[model samples]
Target: MRSIIAFFLFIFLIHSVQAAPLLQATISRESQVIGNDGVTHTSVFQERMYRDQNNVWLERVLPKHHQHSTDAKNKTSHKHLDLSETAQHYFLDNKKSTRLNLVLPEDKTVIHLQTVDIEMLGLTNCWTCVFSIFDSQSVKKMKITQQGNGYTWYESQNAKNKIKIKWAKLQPDQNPHPTSEYYATMDSIWKIHLERICRLWGLNLVKE
Candidate 1:
């Protein structure tokens, strides 16, 4: 009877841990856009994400050259990519469906994003939606090839346009999330003025 009780308690403990695991990570990436005129533009981006039982946070900073707008927020140590410093923030359970905030310090607008927008962000949701990348329809359209323990996502339809996705430094178990992620695309080189991660996760800056 004692052995059976211990066995059941051990199983219960394992199940409890598996039910909900905490994820906290920061992913950095460098991207370049190759123009048709043979000019290539490079940018650096960083994403900080943290989630536990009741609280959540996510922030993304794009290269000054790639400065664009959407909505999201937060603060982490970041490097100066250039003069164009732009960013955004989101709140998962903020109650409001939509919102927009202007950040004076960065000289750009931040869009308040909903958690539901992960479907539109592809692997970026690795910042918020830990499991969505595996199920996103957009990701499903790409060819995902395993790289050691990581996976690489790339466009299979267009030859000239390219977007590369890779994740590294995943945790051993219990709701693993990547410690680093890489994303790059050249499809909209001419059209987009800025590339932001507003819809990636609803986050508010820790300070001004």
Candidate 2:
């Protein structure tokens, strides 16, 4: 009876971890930002962190059809975040709060954009997951582009200049795929890096 109980407990724990939503960072503070041009702008940003095991599998949120279908077979389905509505859906379902809303920042001054790349976890089909954060908002918009070394986030217009604040890549490449382990590693690294960024910006990660 004791062994049976222990085995059931272990299985239950594993399932709980696997069932959780993908982990991510949350934007938590806002302030008035004035650029060098003397234009007053709104600085929007949230604290960022990686979600634990349950959250790491959030990639599955993408339609199963897109995941299973070939590029040509589901050309239309692959069009996920390209549309604003789709992006909005993702943002809402993530459950993390933002520091600001639809209000556009006041000043339009161009701010220098910097990027950090980290390896992604749980993606057997792709090589890299580019996690990008904007200076204007805390929500980190992620684009899972093709996997390869030639990939450059700084050059992509979709990753626009000015508003971009930071970047982190999570790499996971293995044949036959080690999805869970890679996802956990990526989450751990992202959480640590995000905490460091918050400290540098004088933001309180968990407090708000």
Candidate 3:
């Protein structure tokens, strides 16, 4: 009886460790835009993410302290926005096949999608891959080119859109905080932009 109780205690401890939540926070993000008029503008923001096993929550931090609105008559209105309202939650299940549930906070709506491809389950940890799963057709057409150790370049078939990413190096004793910088160019509209990630936590880097 003593040996059996010890075995059960060990199993419970393993389960508790596996159920721990991972918190990922992006402290800052800088975005630079160059328009056709030869003008450049830059903006910065922050984001937070949390993952508990198969569920993840992504929150985009709005720069404004209050949510602003304009009436039909062009009148401006301001209202305080709750931080909790900014999160979009994702739930993934891979029991038999890959399945996803995207929950939108504003409308309290749940979007469900399922696929037979098992590989899709592994991509939930990536920032881009989460959205790419919704548009697998477009992802198939895009070409990926690796420049070197931490640089990746992507281009459209028409060459009208291009994106380059610089990934951060892995650190010791961490759950993989994969911060990155993105440089995107849209030749069709003569626009170029650079988005840099200042800090990140929790997400794993999957190099394509």
Candidate 4:
């Protein structure tokens, strides 16, 4: 009887870990730019992030009136901007192999990246870091300062361009779906490089 009870308990523990709910959070991004006329323009947007034990999903909320051009000739060759409704899913296995799938709902297309180098692309192992959309190299060049609260502020500038980011503490999410099938794909190389780069920059990487 004791052995049987122990076996059942072990099974239950395994099931609990496999069925754990995803962690969700809302990420807000604000951009300010000074035009040639010396006018400051500001824009804000929000994204949703969901994370499970081994996967992450990032959804970019688009405006309801947002339109997509179907003109093939007018289409830009840039893979990142060609999407209408953008979402990304990342899968990481126990061995640290990573894969990404870029889901474009409007175009009904999914871009699969079988192998990705996160450092080369300026990405980190932390899912939240994706909110910045800037490569790790660029992030290294940016200035980081602690805000009054738990928030962190980042800023970067060049002769003709400037960017700023404010990172807030993550809050508990009430709803998050299971890992979806849309996002990019990566390999272990990505994991290795991303961890190294993040460490070099004194950035934290979420480990599960």
Model number with the top lDDT = 4
lDDT (Cα atoms) of all candidates against the true structure: 0.37, 0.24, 0.41, 0.45
Instruction: List the candidates ranked by TM-score, beginning with the highest.
Output: 4, 3, 1, 2
Winning candidate number (TM-score): 4
Ranked candidates, highest lDDT first: 4, 3, 1, 2
Please list the residue runs of candidate 1 whose C-alpha ends up more than 4 Å from where it truly belongs after superposition. 1-22, 53-56, 60-89, 94-144, 147-173, 176-208
Question: What is every candidate's alpha-carbon RMSD to the true fold?
Answer: 15.6, 21.2, 13.1, 15.6
Let me know the TM-score candidate 2 reaches against the reference structure: 0.22
Clashes of each: 12, 20, 0, 13
Off by over 4 Å in 3: 1-18, 68-85, 95-177, 184-208
Give each model a TM-score: 0.39, 0.22, 0.42, 0.44
Query: RMSD in Å for candidate 3, one decimal?
Result: 13.1
Candidate number with the higher lDDT (2 or 4): 4
Candidate 1 positional error at 202, Å: 23
Q: Of 1 and 2, which scores higher on lDDT? A: 1
- Looking at model 3, the pairs that clash are none
TM-score of 1: 0.39
**Which 10-residue span in candidate 1 carries the lowest summed lDDT?**
8-17
Candidate 2 weakest lDDT stretch, 10 residues: 174-183
**lDDT by residue (tens digit), candidate 4, 83-174:** 33656767665565555655555444555544444344444555434423334455457687546565556665555444554444434642
> Can you write out model 3's per-residue Cα lDDT over 91-181, one digit (the tens) per residue?
4443522244433344343334344322343324343344221233443465766546654444443345454333333455333222443
